[model samples]
Structure formats: structure tokens, C-alpha cells
Target: MSTTKGHADRDVTEDLLDGVAGWGPVLCHLGIFELVPVTFDLGIPLVARWMNDPAVAAYWDLAGPEIRTTRHIRVQLHGDGRSVPCLGVLNGTPMSYWEIYRADLDQLARYYPALPQDTGIHLLIGAPEDRGRGVGGILLRAVTELVLDKRPACRQVVGEPDVRNASSRRVFRKAGFDFVAEVDLLSKRAALMIRDRLTLYPYEIPRFDGYS
Candidate 1:
């Protein structure tokens, strides 16, 4: 058990290093435009505004207090045993957000093979005033570059969206993710679509760990 834990830790460290080193040159250029960081608090309102938009909310099935509660942001920022939130800022202003998480594949088993680390990106573009100005696209591109540079070991990143949300699906496709599957929600008829990239990883978590 001790040796296994040690090995895992080492691999994680290596992954982080490889990811960072690979992006070092890009980071220097990114600094000129100032696109950085994956965590944010000042951007909460931006996220709330975009996510709360009726058109946006239509797909999420979130409304009223559920949308108003701080729990969602809290979970997005702190959930999955992470301490820092992954937020993207543009021109010194918060414009997008994402998270790196290790989620239980047991729940995803109906669709994908189990993964040891499941990275995810939840991008939100606020300041509707800035919508279609290329801000969302730029930030997403930057975030993808950031993730690839920061997480070298990640073979794939996963995203789920409402089947009807065309705009978001386009942004994801532009970011290099491929359509993987469509998942049935609680309603059975309504489904969430799944997308992923084939980055490839060296390790995987077994399906039955007996802890869940």
C-alpha cells in the first residue's frame, strides 16, 4: 500500500512537471495578453449572470434558488478534494472557468470506460455585452492550452451538455473535443451528451474498488 501510494504521488508530480514544461514557451507569450489561473472568486457574478441566463438555464434544468445558492459555485471550486478553483481571466477580467476533478467512473460506467483521473472544463462567458466578440473563443482556447500544458498525464477531458445547447457544443468542438456518447438523464427521454478527447493515460482505476 505504501509503495503504491508513493508511486502514484511520483507519477502525479511527473505529470505536473511534464505539463508545465511543455507549455513554458506558450506561457511566456500568454503573459503578454495576461491569460492565466483556473480559480476565481471575483468572477462569481460573471459565472452567475451567464449561467442564470434563461436561454442558458433552459438546458441545465436549474432555476430559482437552486441557481441562486452558492453551493454550485462552491462545489465547482472546492469539490473533488481540490483546494483551488480553475478560473480563466481575460484582459485582467474573469471570463471563464474550469475544474480538474477525479470523479467516480462507476456512475459513468454506462457510457465510458473507467478512468483514474477525469478532468473537466465548465466554461462560462459572462458580460453578455462581450458575447460574440471572440472573448469566449479566446478564453476557451487559452484554457485548453493551459490544461494541456498543466496536465501532461491526462489522456482525455470530459464534458457534458444538454442536447439542445448548440452554442456550447460548438465552442467545445472548436476546442478539439470529439463527440463520445449521449447519456440518459433521470427523465429517460431528456439526455445529456458526452464529449471527450483521446489524450491517452498510463494508468486507470479498477471498476470495483469496494469503497463506494
Candidate 2:
């Protein structure tokens, strides 16, 4: 019964996302220091840094620190008409960075229906010095609020954290994302979490796909 209920919730959430994919704000990156507009040029380098961060690469599918890998991420950023918004995580002190991206609506719809109506948040604490300072929690909320402020079309923000990552799970839950699913993929297990826009800032809740 518990499993069935979980699936039911996910199905409904997906439907909700699909229903609102094209409704509001198109692209915006909300960060601590500034509210920057979205663009491909800004997105590529940030994603390159994210993909190459050893901390992030350890669990993700991307290769580490390779120029070629960065190039590949760059291509993806430009090839797709996706919007990537990156924010430097500075809360009266320096810490790691956080980025949120929106991909082509129809492509996202392939994996999860209604994904076009949302924006996905990917949080990375790559800077070792920033690891234990309670900054992850701050980055999570700030980024979400930023998205809500810039793009009112986003209805929900989603994240996929490995189930083994207890710290991250706590962060997402604190940010108000409910657990939607736990599944095995490419030999690892991960959790699907979503934050509702209505419960979020007052934006229209556009669909977004959560990717690492």
C-alpha cells in the first residue's frame, strides 16, 4: 500500500507538471549576490565547473576535469535551447556554487510528463572548505526562491539525490520537497523529490526536469 501510494503521488505530480509546462517565466538564475538573466554563454562555464568538480563527478555520470568533458557539457548547453542559471553561493562568506537549469519542454516530457512546467534544482557543494558550514541548506532555499522570483511559470522545483546521501535528503526535505520515488539507475539508487510552487513563492510554476 505504501508503494502504491507513492506511485500514485508521482503520477499526479507528473500530470500537474505537464498541465502547466508552458505557463510562466522562461529562464532566470536566482543567486545570493544577484538576479541574473539566463543565457547560454553564462551557463556553459558554470556547468563545466560543476561537472568537473570531483565531489560532483564522484556520483554523477560525467567525466572529471577533462577539457573534453567540459566541451561536451558546453555543447549540450548550446545545442539545446535549454536555459541554465547559475548562482554563486555567498551568504556573508564564500562557499560553493549552485545551479538550476531548464531543458526543452518536450524532451523533458518524454521521461516525466509535465516536466516542461517546472525547473529543476541541482545543488553541489564542491568546495571542500564549504562542506560543513550549513551552507548547503542556504543554497537550496536561495536558489529555489530565486527561481520563483525570476520565472513565475515554474510550478515546482525537483531534485534527485542518491538515497545514500542522508545529508542531501535532509536538505531537500527542509526545503519542502516531498519524496516521490526511489529507484535504481546505472547501479546506483536515488530519490526523486519535488517542491510544490503553490507552497513555494507566488510564481506560476513552470515545468522543469531535475538532472545532475
Candidate 3:
């Protein structure tokens, strides 16, 4: 159910992500944040360790072994340039994992009214010390702003965090994303969140009646 109409015949040589490797670093309240494109040699072992964390595994479900994480990342690494896996490096340390993709050309398009050049984000804060603080929101804001800044054609940045994960949903809202809807994905019920280019500033905290 991929909505790859205009993109169906796109040249394989053209990057669907518009070269995330060159997006460069952005300054944030936390520190200088950068999205370093993932490589098997550098990303596999680190990501595998994060996946094994109890808090991460409960939702991501890729907890078993390094091979499982390798296979997961390998698919995106070798696939059509629609998705790019990146390591979130803050200041000087790689502390998070992210997947930036074209939502309009993705399976997610089937579940929502997606617009052309819509970008999607998938994130996981890697270390326990970085969790439960304001790190996720700060990094999410920086990355979303980076996406909108680097990809002008992309009018919005979207994410689907598990509905049960109240902390994750709150992080999105704190990052200036509004709750769009509840979508039922294959593995979990997700809370669709969206941050539009039109309202990237003057941050407003969204109010949810009884979401949690």
C-alpha cells in the first residue's frame, strides 16, 4: 500500500531523501546536533546494544541479538534511497538513532492523507542516562527543524510513537508537534504526530483531554 505514484519511475540514482548525509549539524539548546548517516561497521554494534535495553525493546521489539539489528538496518541501507538511518550525535557523542524517510512514498501513506514530499521520523534515545529527562524533546526539535530546513519541499515532519508510551507522546508535543490521530499499525497502536513548516516557531504546548 505504498503511495509512490510520482515516485514510481524516479531515477534510482536520485536520492529520495535529498542527501541526508549532507544536511550538516544544527545548533540547539542542548548542544550541536548532527545526523550522521549510518554505516554497518559503526552503527550495528551500537544500535544492537540499544535495542537490547529493556525500555527500548518493549516498544521496538528488536531485542535478541546483533544479527537482528544488523538485518533491520541492512534493509534500509540497501533498499531504494527512500529511508536513511542516522546516528544522532550531540556535541561529540552518538546518543540516539533516527530514520528519516519520505512518508508520501512510504507504507505509512496508506494509513493517512499524506502530502507530497512529506517527511517521516523514527527515533530512539540510546542510553538510559539520557532517558526520562528533556533530552528527547530537545533532540526531536533540533532534528525536525533540520529536516524542514534542509528539505524545503517537505512541508511537514511526522512521527508515529506508540500510543501507550505517554512519555514519547509528550516529548513530541514538547517538540512542537501536534497529535494528529490514533492509527492502528501491525505491531502497535500508534499516536500520529505532526510538525508543520508553517508553525515551526513560537512553540505552543498542545493539550490532550485524556490521551494517556
Quick one: best lDDT, which candidate? Answer: 3
lDDT of 2: 0.52
Model 3, range 1-212, lDDT digits (tens) per residue? 12222332224413687788877777778867888988877877999999999999998999997999888887776677677789999877999999898888877777888889999999999999998999999999888988887787989899999998998999999999999899887778889999989988755322223223
TM-score of each: 0.61, 0.61, 0.88
Q: Which segments of candidate 2 are over 4 A away from where they belong?
A: 1-31, 35-54, 61-63, 83-95, 103-115, 184-188, 201-212
What TM-score does candidate 2 reach? 0.61
lDDT of 3 at 87: 95
* Candidate 1 vs 2: which has more lDDT: 2
lDDT of 3: 0.82
Per-residue alpha-carbon lDDT of candidate 2 for residues 31-54, written as tens digits (9 for 90 to 100): 323323223444445555656766
User: Which is the better candidate, 2 or 3, if ranked by TM-score?
Assistant: 3
- The sequence of per-residue lDDT tens digits that candidate 1 reaches over residues 1-212 is 00011232323533433322123222222232233333344545555666677765675444455346245555433332322234454435555545444322324434566455545555556556765565555555555555544665545566555557677767766556677667764432222333333542233311222222
How far does residue 182 in candidate 1 sit from its true spot (Å)?
1.2
Off by over 4 Å in 1: 1-41, 61-67, 76-78, 82-85, 103-106, 186-212
Pick by TM-score: which candidate is best? 3
Candidate 3: TM-score? 0.88
For model 3, the superposed segments whose C-alpha errors exceed 4 Å read 1-14, 202-212
